[model samples]
Target: MEFWRYYRVIRRRRWLILLGTLAAVLMVVYWNYTTPTMYIGKTTLMEPKGQTQDGVPLFQSQMMGTMLDPQLQLSNLGNIATSQKVLSNAAQSLAELGLKMDPEDILAATSVHPERDTNILAIEVTLPDEQEAKVAADAIATEFKKTYDELNNQALKDSRNFIEGQINSTRNAMVKAQDALRRYKEQNGVVEINQQLADSVQNLYLAQTNANQAQINHEAAASRAMKAATELAKLPESQIAGTSISRNPIWERLSESLTDLETKKAAMLNGVPGQPRRGPNHPEVVALQAQINDVKDQLSKTKSDYIASTQQAKNPVWQTAYGNWFQAKVEDVATGAQAAAAENVIKKMKSEMSQLPAKEAELAKLQVDLKAATDTYSLMKSKLDEAKIRENQGSSEVALRTIDPAHVTEAHNNGLLKLALALVLAPLMGIGVAFLLHYTDNTVKTAADAEKLLGLPVLTAIPGSKAHSLPRQHCPEIMDVAYQMLTSNLWVATQNQADNGIVMVSAEPDAGRSVNASNLAVALAREGAKVILVDADLRKPTQHLIFGVDNKVGLTNVLSGGATLEDALALTRVQGLLLIPAGPVPDNPVKLLRSPEMKEFVDQVKEFADFVVFDTPAGVTFPDPVLVASQVGSAVVVHSAGRVPRGSEAELRQRLESIGVRLIGAVLNKVRREDSSSFFHYHRSYEGVVMPQLTSGKKAIKSGPRDQA
Candidate 1:
């Protein structure tokens, strides 16, 4: 239901939505056509495998390896491709090619990125001219490669220089070590130093054997002392000599009570040997058992309070163990002293051995220093050679490779995407506007709105006509049915009332007040009742034109005494229906309608016709309708659907009610097809059935025609 309501709103404002959408689409198309075309040039590069021609690693250092990693290298290359240095060089190159481009412009046009999950970099340049784009892409790539190579080569040069310095330092150190060794040998007269050192080592080994024996004996004595100490710890410090136990008289009395209770319980249960053995359930047995438990608890408490005494004495076994422990500890101390003396002797022997040959020890140390320097010089020399080789071979060619040269291609204009977006957004924007207008529109569009505003039921909703050129009889059957329904509702509302006059009024002009009034009169006349439609709107009358009658003299004439009500009445095409045009424009319709003569005119019309519908101008703007309604004693408000301003109907209704006029409900006039109820859809089924036109022999009344009903 909600969707249908929104659909009706869109349908009512379809032309507005269409125009807005078309304008948006045209704008998008014009923008796309007027936009300049752009050309793109792209270049591709790949990371080097970091392998030398001789199947050796080119970058051996941790830093070098990181700099050459595939992912990291590709990322660095991407940055370099768009760097200021590369872009400036590219701009200069472009200037040479007759394209005076700025570095900023080139930078703005250029984009560099690494391909996902691949050791590849893509550099793109977009420009209006194809040749410029291609040249710029190529220049940036070439410059980036050169810059990268220069960085790598500089690193290699630094490494080579460092290695060369180490080599020089190591050579000097090696020479010094050789000379020091020769001097040490000469000064000490140390010949066959290894043989002399071996003799001194043999003597040191014998002394060490004696020290080991002393250490073993000390360890054995310490173990014995530990065992004796453990046994001593297990012995008691003091021994009990004798002990005595004493019982409490209270405990003895409780025990005797418990025995007596148990004896009585047994007698109660055995029942004197065989007379009658009582069961355990006997009350006497239960009582005796509880007494026994009480006595037992008391005895247990008394036992805990009993006293005990003892006499302490020395333990012979403990004394013997203590003596043994002391003797072992004394022996352990003596052994420890002997082990210390042995250790001291070994230290003295080691000191004597250390003094064997200082020149031999110094010569050995100098020889070790010379061997280390020689090895270091050899390693640095090899590294320096490798660095020089790496520097000679260009770093760029070994570290990076060009996968694809820059080439020209047409850049994507995204015309289709823009067109699609415009197409999609245009309707959405239009719909949004439609809803905005819908919510902002303060008018009655449906019967519900009228009823809600007027606080009264809606009589009927008259479907609007699109063919103004056609005659009224040729109108669609739906409109006729609507008028009939209105007439029926009005009859039911006013059937029991004394007054037969109804003043038709509207809040705004062009609300089809006159048309509704004429149609209602026709509907009532068709029901076999006399009907009179009075165009009381003296300022602007339309009933004459609606019924094809002359408006030379009407209600105004009758009220002004220019003619009687009978003389002013004009016959219409509808049977049993008479029309009274509003006649000449009045200077003051309000004063005339409020006069007593107007009240007399309404009473006369009520007596002449079964129903009298007085057509009036906009009640909200003019007091003519309200004045007429006061004399007529009843009012029927007619409002154009979706055209009456908010609160206008309510104000008009309040005016009528304030004058003590009976509100006969409202009629939603000029309702569009979309706003009509579903019940009205049956008109489509009757579209093929042509409605018969009712014709009367009586001709239309011209000027001065009187109808004496």
Candidate 2:
């Protein structure tokens, strides 16, 4: 999370990140040098106008308007342009132009797009060469137009044929209707008969009315005649023969003369009787009787004459009831004959009326059939004419126009941009990998790593070297300078402590604790401080070997009371410095170090020496360093870079702090000079000449003649 922490991770794993970044950059560069370039050509086309001159549909354009869906037109055109048929034609055309190409290849290289919101198509072709791209684009467009025209012409021809078939069917229907009308007229024997039919119906009705009236009159006359005959039959035959007697004038005159004669006779007879009864035939009586007889005879003759005259008259009125009956009989016979004649007329008229309905219905049906056929025929003829006109005027060529001809252009390349991106990304990828390695690697590789893990200040980074020879074979100044800084930092860090005893320890063995302690003690003595370096690692003592001193009588002998304190101390090669080795590898070194004698030894050593630096065993796996740490005035942990585990360093610091050990600070040993990245690296080059190798019981002075104090 912090900037220095990230920097340390990168610095420690610099080789790993560098190697990975270089590999990625090299791969990108290799790819940038090996691919080919292409060229492009493009063309544009516009759809044909929908109308013609006079703004009316011409050459079946109306049909086209109804059938051609505008939404699908653009898509259809695009598909046709890139189709196999178009491509094949284009390939043939190119071959003729002396530049052969595969149809499939041409199709693969061609692309068509229908421009939105406009009746335009944009066609593009890509090829290895500019001229080839231009040629391919133009050829494809020309072939597509030709194919569209062929398909359109075929469609028009099919439409015309269909219309012709419809016209023929209408003509047949017209002929059938005409024939049916002619047959109906011939069968019924009538042509235009509406007026005649109306006249016949009116005449039949009039005849029926006349016959009905005549029959009524005849029936009345027959009834009167029958009544008269019945009355005459009831009368006598003599009364029937004397029917005209009352209307005779001769008879009336004769009867009047007789009546006058009879009256005169009656008067004469009455006068004679009153005068005297006369004898049998008195004159007056005789004259009256003779007059009455003459008058009676005359009246009879007159009656006979009147009756004969009435009966003999030809056109006389009927005077007798029997005579009237005879006249009524003649009327009844004549009227009955008239009634039969009227009935015959009615039958004839009804027969004529029945024939009229059939004739009128047939005529009406024929008229309707004729009209339907005639109208249908006329319509078909009009449409046939229109079809013919359109066919004659139709154009065989398609209406596509080239708005922009094909042209060539350079294709775009983005290799440089891609190369730049690869360059930038390589280092980032490498840094990410470095961080991963840092997290996975748990060893302490820097003072920051140790400090962060242990929660302690790193006193100094003792610059390390690859050489493994003795101190006499190399310069000790780098080590001496680092130890001198360590010595100063420790004094200041523990100035408040009650004692001047210092113990050096690490979390684990092989962490350079003995080396750092011996160097620090020698450096302190060189500064005019009387420093006693004790090898408190009774289990694995290296101090005696490092200082070239005998380890026969050391800290163990002093603690066990096998030797005196002054006898156990061995003088080191450095002035003002003393060395005490482990007297022997005791069976129980921890018990010997924990004894009261060990505590007394520590007190007495601190009293005699200005600085007592105890080189204890690694405190992590062994408890010797922690035991000694508690007894000493101050404790300092020494960690070797890239050797001590970060976890162990943390544990060691916690244990010491828990036990109340006065932990001053930690020293980062074996730090590479190149990675110091601080002011320490600047001073590392000033390491003086090597120190002279120390011999047995011999005190070695500073090699370069530096002052002791």
Candidate 3:
């Protein structure tokens, strides 16, 4: 999970990645060495520069004289170069030259690449023979040029024929339109009708002017009559009495009498200057007042009659005003009638002018047809002349000039590219496979593995020591530090337990359980503690060989009660350390290890020794290790780093836990110290000199308290 842990895996499996990469690259190299080489021929052709060939443009112009884009032209040329017709022609020419190559073969071996943004085509051909490659390339180029010229000539000829036919058809149409125009002019006797149409329009406008003047005059007359009539009708009856009321004789006579009587009444009421003026009913005053009342009554009646007669059109002044208004209305009606006649005349003239436009439209249509036909005929004739000139040019107008003739060269087998691909992919694949193996591998290799696999702390990591191979102890100080750490951790783990027995065992055989137990015993003994390492693996005991002790009498003899502890216990080369080797192979190591005598012996040894480490058989394969582990009551599982599978370690821890063995911790034994420094390798304090040494193969230690004791 950490970067360093992944780096460790890569470092450990670096050989595999290297081997895989080398193998892949070597395979590619071998293939390249064995593969056959091919010869390639190349030729280049430049595009036509739109130059004229004998008065004809190389790029033929259309009837409309429009030239194609250069890019489009180049694309068409490329297509023709690779076209089946050109390729087949090339094949046929080659066959004629005694080279019977199939068209498909030639096509397959040939490639046409048109340079982008440039009007150059590069043709390449690869074949077995160099000369054949050159010949094939040159032949294909020649055939392409020839086929393109032929196709271009055919297109030009088709264009000429089509243009000629169009020109003839247009000429005929132009002649017909001309004849129709002449006939129309003769039949209609119309040289120019615009002037006649203009004159008719002028006449209609003049009529409209006269009609407008008449309407103005009639409106003025009507307005004057209306004003006169309204003024006469609005006048008060008193103001019109002489003029308007005289028309009614009865009202005029009544008005005169009422005025005379009112004048006499006013004089009578005056009473001659100071008289009591008719205080009482004077006869003269009474008479005049009565006359005035009667006259007033008569005047009111006559005025009512006059007003009613005026409303009924009987008033003389109202009649005169009404007659004048009627006369004005008649004049207005007559003038409007004349204006309507003029409008009708104008409509007739407009109708005739609208017909003139039809004739003008006909004439314009004939003129347009004649002009279009003439233009088309002239254009087609010019295009036809160009086409004839091009045809006479002998297809040179569309011919291709070889910029560079075909040349032969050796074809690379693409080994360099293959090598490059291999070089790039091989390492990647190797790394992928390496990481795959690392992920799939379930072995316990580091302290993290111990914690992950068994949930146990790694008490110490004893790296692979040279002491195992040599008779003399020549291991680095890391080994000493590892054993010291192991013994110290064991003491700390078992400080609460009264029993001093600890069984060092592994999930499988040869997992450094014996070596770790012996080394830890020596380390403890060096601390001045009485340490005993008992080889309990009677099936395959290794402590006897490691400490150079006699296996003729050891744990087995003591457990069987055939010999006393003093006789079975052998002093090792390490001072203060005792070894009890597994005596001669037994018939039933499990029964022997499980005997009560074995427990008593372990208790007796614990009584004498400060610490006892029992080297038991592998717990996974043999039950003796489990029996010894149960009797010992304490366990230190020694797992060889990068060797023991975690699955087995987990299974062993589960079994030991289930059986009530006090598992102190696990020691990752035989850890290979990576050259890349780590915490374990940093303590190289013993690089200077040797302090003391342990003897191997039955030699008792000559130093330390062993000799003195």
Candidate 4:
């Protein structure tokens, strides 16, 4: 059902959608015809695998080869091929071929990319002329090759120069180191330091041994001298050889005289015992002692001159001890002098040994420096030789080979794709616009719309009439059923009201208000009720035309007191139905409808029929309908689908209710069948059953109503 409702909206605007799609297709066709045809020229090149153009290995090790990325190399080559220098050269080459172009233009027309999973590169150029495209491709490829070769040669030259510089620097360092070592050796006298150090160690050992031996010998000699001296001291210089006694006569006489003098001196000193005693200190005693001392001296002189007795023989043991002592002392002095001389030699040897290590260390350091410089110079010389070889070859590590020359072909066209896109998208755009207009359109298009807008129940949805140019009498059976439903719903709504009369009003003109009033009266009369449809719209009367009644004098005439109710009333062909036309348009319908006679006319009509439906003009245009509805006391809005704006209907309902007119409901007229809800499907189902009964009932009503009238 939802889809059907949308279908109805599209169906109504189908012509608009068709026109939009056609316009889009025409535009696409024009664009496709006017667009220029393009041609493409292509060329192919291959990158060398891990070697130079001269077949020299690019990498020295397998690890380096594995780390090499083909993609990264391709990217670098692509950048170089498209660089400014290459492009400028290519442009100049193109000019030589009679095609003047700028570098930017050539760049814009060219594309370079590497083929996937391969070492192949593709270069393409696109232009309007096939020959021009081919020429441009060739020029670009030639220039790129020349530039790449030049760059490779220049790189090789730079590598060779660098290696040469390193070799020269290393040679200089080696020479300096050699000179420094020679100077150091000459300054320190460090010729064969290892051998010299060994010799010094041996000599120091011999000197130490000699010093120790001499010291021992000196101590032994000194001990022997001490023993000899002790023995010599104990033995005297000469032993007492023999004891001798001899006396001279003169010595004996002198001894006797000396003894007599001594006896006289003693007597004088003691004083004679018998003669007068004399003091020893007396003169006579002193003189006598002096004479005795003189005599004793004379006796000693005589004893000395006269020898006593002597033995003259040397001691052999004493003489031997003295000689041994003298020999030991001389040996001790000689040993001591030898020990001192040996000590001086050991000290000199030790001093020389201690200095040998420092000289050895210095010599070792200078030798190490010279060896390092020589090794470095050798390595650099080898590298320089290799660089010179590479420079002579004059090629880069990654080489290029032309696989295919430039060739031209037609470029792919997308005209059909554009047409297909237009076909698909044009309809979508039209649909979007249709929905936009549908949603923005404020008019009531369905029964639900009418009900929701007016806040009233929808009485019925009348199918659009097939013969809208004809009278209501020629309308289809579906319309008749719709009117019947409206009458029944209105009847139920007004059953408890004091007045059974209702005013039929619309928000706008051409809403089928008069037609709905006429049909509703006919449907009510067919149900065996007396019905009267009064054309209260004096401003724009449509009921007379719908019912084909005379309208010379009707509601306006009665309201203006120009005609009587009996004179204005006319019978319709519908059984039990009556008509009162608008009865000539009045200049001022509002004043007439607002008069006191309008109420009386309404009361008299209510008493004469079961229902009195008053058809009024559009409420939004004139106040005539509001005035009439105010008198009728009840109203039913008749709205053509998508004809009357919702706001107008709401305003009309407000006006009627404000004037005390009860709004029964609204009728959604002229609704398309597809827009109707599922409830209307029952009408289609029971069409066969209801059509016969309706025909027979109409026959009965026509016959019976004619006889009674």
Count of backbone collisions within predicted model 1: 0
- Put the candidates in TM-score order, highest first: 1, 3, 4, 2
Q: For each candidate, what is the lDDT?
A: 0.73, 0.70, 0.71, 0.74
Candidate 3's residue-wise lDDT over 549-583, tens digit each?
67788777787778887777786666678788889
- Look at candidate 1 and tell me the lDDT of residue 105: 91
- Against the true structure, candidate 1 reaches a TM-score of 0.60
Error of 3 at 466 (Å): 5.8
- In candidate 3, clashing pairs total 1
Poorest stretch of ten by lDDT in candidate 4: 56-65
lDDT of 4 by residue, 631-704 (tens): 88888888788653425666677778777878888888888766776335755586546464332233221233
Candidate 4's displacement at residue 447, Å, is 2.1
lDDT of 1 by residue, 1-709 (tens): 8988888888888988899889988988998899888998999977666543221122222122112346666767777777888788877877887888888998899898898878788889999888878888888888888777776566456556655776797689778877887787788775565876655555544454445445544654565568668988999967998877787777777877787888667656643321234578788777778888888877766763454788888766677667656765766787688778877866775676557676554554455456655665675577668767766774644566889999989988888898899889988888899989988776678888777666778899888786421226666667767777887898899888888888888877888887778878887777677778898888877778878888888888999999988778887766778888888988888778888898888887787777888888898688888888888888888878865343456667777888798887888887777776543465546655766745544423222325334
Question: What CA root-mean-square deviation does each model show from the true structure?
Answer: 30.5, 58.3, 43.4, 57.2
Which candidate model has the greater lDDT, 1 or 4? Answer: 4
Say which candidate scores most in lDDT.
4
Off by over 4 Å in 2: 1-21, 37-410, 421-455, 461-481, 494-498, 508-515, 525-532, 535-592, 595-609, 639-651, 669-709
Give the TM-scores of the predictions, in the order they appear: 0.60, 0.52, 0.57, 0.56
Give candidate 1 misplaced runs (Cα > 4 Å): 6-10, 16-39, 49-76, 103-109, 127-129, 150-394, 397-399, 410-442, 468-474, 526-528, 545-552, 678-683, 693-709
